[model samples]
Target: MQQVFFRLLGPPEIYYNDQPIRIPRRRSRALLYYMVSTHTPQPRERLMNLLCGDMDDESARRAFKTMLAEVRSQLRNIDPSIEWITNDEDRLTFNPLAPIWLDTEIFEKATANRQSNLSLAIKLYRNNFLDGFFLKGSPDFDAWAQSTRDHFQRLYMLALQNMAEVYETNHQLEEAITCIHMLLTADPLSEDAHAHLMRLYWQTGDRTQALRQYERLGKVLAEEFSVQPLATTQELYRQIASNANTLTQPATPLDRTVHPPDPPLQATAETPVVEVRLPYVGRVRELNWLKDQLLGHEHERSMLMLRGEIGIGKTRLLQEMIEGYCTDWRILHATCQEAESKNHYHPLTEALRSELNRQDIGRLELYPVWRAQLERLVPDLFYTGATDNTVDAHHNYTGFEHISDSSATLLADALVALLNQLATPQHPILLLLDDVQWCDKGTLGLLAHLARYVHRREVFILLMYSPGSGEQRLAALRNNATRLGILAEVELEPLSRADIHELVTLFSQLNKPGDRRLHTIDRHISGDWCYQQSEGNPFYALAWLETVWDQPETFVPARIQEQVTIQLGQLSQNARHLLQLAACQQDSFDLAQLGSQLGFTLATTLDACTELITQRLVVADPVTTTSLYTFTHKTARTYITGSMNRIERHMLTQTASRIADPEAIS
Candidate 1:
């Protein structure tokens, strides 16, 4: 499936798996939006009037045909397989089941599965439908858009209100406070929202803020309608103020309380020790599944593909899962890298060298021929005096030598046999291949061979990769493994709200018995801030937590910047330039307008955006669609913008401003 995304929430956007296609002409965009919104057949005359109100039948008909053609052509340019618009001579309708991703559709369908989708629905309602967009002259279209926007706005408000109540019921005062604040932002006259927010502020131990919120509400009411807050709100405010007064008293002067400092003790033989372990959170199910396999009586080899976005904590989770079993299990871990992808068996060689010693396993009676093949990977088996013959230095593929098909098979068999030796009943093997997408074809060949014997062995294979960045390299292997039921993929998603809180709480109090923490005292507030900054990616969340709040620039450190640049390096010059320009805009920028300023054709812009979008560097700005796209991650934008020299950055920003009204620039 191409995975079509008809984004109608903020500003109109259409995506076919990261390829964003926009109808260049205003009338065409308007026509497409109308049809897509209605999803019903429209009489030819209705559309004609919308576009050419005063034209003769023939002239209007010609105009309508041309507009429709442009829309169809634009959609076709991104993906030809999907017919976005279908019509006969009579009327036009959207293909609803072009198998799409629409937030409105998701919200509608969430009724069937309320608890699970409600949170998603709430997240998707970032702003009013088409928050700032207007079809200035098309009155009918404007009316339709306005009504539709109101409908979604009402749904969003209702959803947020319900969410706030749920949070309050669960005693999540900070979360509830956030929801109520959003509710008021959208509907400022909401008395219930103000009341809930005031109560929530009190519940969270902010008595001063609670009283201040009441004042703010009073001001808003007076400004809006020259009226006071409801009697109920005033009474509640009085109750809070009464409690505050009761709790406050003149501070009794401390009795010159400079208690004599305790005499310094003599130094002991050993300094008081405080050992701190790195904090871990979430992934209960994934951890339990691996533990089940580890503790089971029978071992049916399990090949798990752990995939997620970068910094989603794949490696961290792996460490947590394997830590307790280390004493009994022979855990061998190797990380494949992009630079060494072409080096034959590089990952395996590293793993073998780590776990197997030449003086130990290598000296054993593996078949004479098998031992020789193993020697190629395990260098210390035979004393070569530095005359390494495993790779031909002269060959283009320098690190690994090619062998006959039979010999490659022998090498795979030899490694499998070696693993069998290392693996014992008491010590089952856990072979971890991190960054599997970077694994060489040679390693894949060995893995394919090993997979056959794995089903009966006491070994588990975990291949970890990021789905967005390098998945395309192993699509065929992943597909085959899926069909064979040999590979099970467990995706590690971002932490939930509850999970984020747990994570923040655990680490904030690390190595402190008295609950003296490195994080801010209000755990709930700190968790909320972390969620906003990191979006629950554990690595990012932890990074934000560790950073000084005022020095926010340190959150996305140099390593993350290097990794971001590595990803950008893989894109074409067009894509890189487009990304640099988009990054300069701070948030989303108009793709068509930005490209036109740089003399980039629509096709060129789409091609570049498609690459960035698919790689998860940029996305159709999901915050109230502005027909603009942004760097998908805040860190990516931070890195890219910070990479440019100040003069270059300023120049690019000016260039991006040109897109605000390309016509003005023209």
Candidate 2:
């Protein structure tokens, strides 16, 4: 028996006994491709509508029947013994048990199980789905085909990424480079793939190639998106450039190549610590204020809230303050993760665990009763000989019993006592909670309790969170702390253009001494363009500068545009659509104009715009007579426009262009 093979990844084709079989009609080929790709029973009416919707209903029915007949006739001629299409009264499906192979099916199966046959999957994705096979007058079929093409492309890219990571981990530098190169070819604007390729080149002892890759990435980004590389990517490039010689140097061959014996590990009381190394750029005043409050003679306990936008350096500032000012204090730090928000008292539990692990448990002698109560929170602390009898019987009796106010109060008091027992006047405690916006309600309540009693102890609490995210909860906590004279709020503003220039200059001087490249870069660097592009956000500025600094000419890099797109991708579909519509209005668009174009009410538009403002994607003009808003950066506007397909852009542009007459409103 001869096998039948169908190729649908590119142009649809079939082969019988290694001989090509002609698929005569465009509609017949499309029908075959759709049936094979979907691999399920498709309603005959739906298929007809998708393929021949532009025709009259009777004509479309006839076209669909004729197309199905042609497809069946071609299959039967190729393989008379095999059942190809299973036709019924209302639906049509390809026979699953037929002795036929499809490129799309094989590619999908291989990519789906890519962990085992990633190389094979990568090889099987020969081209885009049904490449150059457009059914004229069939918009629905074209749309479906385009979407399917994008899906398969993403899968292929993911497979390549996975293969690269695996190769890099196994120290297969050349193979990793090959995989990343292919990924970049598939999606040239992928900053991540470019970064990986740069790193792989550096690891393979090719410093020049690494530097060239960065330069090429910047050039490509500039040409394609009129944007610079991301600050993170630029920073990586800088690191590679600065340590080129060190990175490229070949390792000395070992004399005997003897494997060293595994050393015996000693048990220690200290938990391993992860040090955060963020560049300390701005926030001098904030740091100074925190230092004074933390180290001042005022005996009252203080709570300082460091609030800012994401990547605006709140966490970095906190880390710097701890290292610079809180050296003499015993610090217990915990970061509330977004994923673990549902875990009650998560941040508090982490802080307690870290503190307990750092200290000798035998030294602190708690009352048998308090020890048992503490065990309720930290079960592992007394894991060896602890009993569950400490749990209140009444609390556990009802399986879903709500924690009573008194029980919560008791738990908070026990937590505070544990902190007090660990701290003294000689060694004050600094409890640092990072990303407090994600902290659970129970953790916030515990902190509130601690704030009320903090005046009696030498402990200082530091909470860091993005301002807009946890507004209501943080405001409530702030009010309580303010009433107690224990709260201080610090809002971090974006760096001034001069400040950004200073930061860039400092980094360049430290890393690339005596290099004249800074002079050329600094000329463009001191302009308002960089400041506006970055919105004075240090992270954004750094990212923008790193990519454009090498080139004397100014152009927006791909990294900057991609970053905005990535941020937008995280928003709700409605919010994202609203912003995209807003982008079509160009610079400094009025809310009324946008609402008019979208056919949305003024209030609904305002609500969506508020989300965009909070994200720092757009900024409302404070001095405008009308309600004017613009994207925070031109790069963002460009990114939004570039992300849309031709049809979407045309539709949005036409709608926005029609709103020439501004509506007057109160």
Candidate 3:
């Protein structure tokens, strides 16, 4: 005899001869549900319509055939005599001639006998209907499905109350009280949960707190649900309040085992392969320093915060750090999004998820620990059970409360759990947070908290942020470090001439190593070139060198001059107008003042500064007394003054003249 059962309330466990089997796929499961729900054979067209309401005839027929074939294969495996197809003209019906034990059927049959079978029915309907199957915009189905689903939910609640009732009848106060707490956690708003908790509290000799729970529930219901307690719940509350005497009796044995239905089978998505190339030259000392900070130490927690202006090789430096340092550590990296900043805990969380899914720590014995930690980072991700969706859904984080809170104490706890599980002498943890400036508040707070205990633990966290951020904001962090005396700072300055030369040699593919011309150009680069033009910034210098090398013809001084001139010359007229306004004041022009001076729109002024950055003419120093644009090369500032036409020069001077503090220096 085949014993089929519906367990839909708790963890789903299926047993066939005490062996576990993978649940059948969706189409097969739906077919089974339909077959069990209907007494007669469903018409072929009707089945097709239900499965594919608007698909063309061929598609619907194909889907219907596939589902039937799958259903037949599964049933045949379990019982060879049971078949899905018995053709009656053009219609199809499932032929289950033998007696079948269906969960819903048993539930209905048991519920018919209120006194004896209610507990059995409650135990039978454990989880919600079709636990993991989502109905797509089918209102009628949703309504009908919800009614049945709620029936199970209601019965489960009653089962807990039944436990309480039986325990109370036996005067098993402790057991009954435990059930009440479980009910409350499952549903804080449950009137039954509140009433049961109140009764338990009173019985436990906490009568005052019990009365408070009632008062709290009254206020909560009034403000939120806008309703009084149900008559049955109120009666229970009154009975608890009125009675102080306890009755003692023998305990009744009750079976609490429940099995929720199987969840959907998930497919793992492909992960993007991230490749990093080590720099040919620059910051060798910094690279070694990073290695020491991240990998050299054997026992202490470590952290490094990489900070510099844009195009200053911060990212490149980090790439080098990862490549050269902490190979033994399980490294995880996440990047922040400018657009996603408003969304809060978006890209950071998503990045963490992607890194987790891509991890191949399967054989490391620390896999379970690592997985537990990863799940804490993204609880919803593991539930998907497939890589592609796991990675993709994280990247597309929808800003749910569950995901946002995952990175908090919960995430920390998970990480600690994972670490404890691994407890390896060799393996350590390394996490890199990119674009710290754009990180959400929750992530920032968690990191700060982690920083406190990270030294004691075997973890390293590295953060990279844009320079020139407010002192009030970042300074406090540094001050805290000093006060705690547990943190260190490494500031990155621009590359030296020798460093730049090494970089040029590393990236350069000159015809001859002994080429005098290459040497001549390298020699021409004085300290001023890096300090001003490159601003000691490696990326800026590299971009400059590349731009010079990519002329229409071979590199010539004339061509280099022309290219540089053209880039400096193409600033929007309004941008130049704003720049002149900025230059006239004490090196900084407030947006309103610049707007009024140049008659330039706020959008135009902002766009012009962005263009200036692209042209490498100005930099947006995010820090300092004022966040303003400045000439990339001081020499370029000189040219701006020298090359201007007489009228333009006069206009700039005139704009400068009107300011209260004309030379508004930062």
Q: For candidate 2, report its TM-score.
A: 0.52
Structural similarity to truth (TM-score) of each candidate: 0.52, 0.52, 0.44
lDDT of 1 by residue, 471-502 (tens): 67777777766676677667887888788888
lDDT of 2 by residue, 1-666 (tens): 676888866666678878898877888888888777665566787788778857999999889889988988888886777778997778788898888887766666675554678898888877877888998988767766765676567667878987887888899989989998888888887766777788888888888998999999899989998999877678778889788454332211122122222221111111111122336776778888777777767645567788776556675676687677767777777777666676767677666555554233435644322343454555544332111112221121221024434335545656666777777887888788876877877778879888776545478788877644344566677778888887877788888777776676665665465555455565555646567667787656666655636643335565565556545755666567778877888577776667656777777776776677766677776567677887777767776787799998898777776664335321
Model 3, global lDDT = 0.54
Clashes of each: 3, 7, 15
Task: Quantify all predictions' global Cα lDDT against the true fold.
Answer: 0.66, 0.68, 0.54
Which prediction has more favorable lDDT, 1 or 2?
2
Colliding residue pairs in candidate 1: 10-624, 10-625, 11-625
**Cα deviation of 440 in candidate 1 (Å)?**
1.3
What range of 10 consecutive residues in model 2 has the weakest lDDT sum? 264-273
Residues 1-666 of candidate 3 have per-residue lDDT tens digits of 756443433443444555654545655555566555443445676566556554688987887788788867766677776554577887676565644555655665564443566557656655666565644632333333443454445445555566666777788988887766655554567665676667667777888777778887788889997998666556655665776465222111121112122221111111111122325466777777777666554524355677755455666776565556545656566666445656645644654454443223232232222333344345443432211111334334442343322124334444544434433447666666665666665556556555666534466667766542221234555556556654556767778877766655654454257665455556664434434455565654554454433233222233224434545455777766666556555544464566666666778766776656555556655555675656655534544565568898887777777665557632
Q: Rank the candidate models, highest TM-score first.
A: 1, 2, 3
Off by over 4 Å in 1: 1-277, 292-301, 359-365, 382-399, 455-457, 511-525, 552-559, 589-597, 601-607, 620-628, 663-666
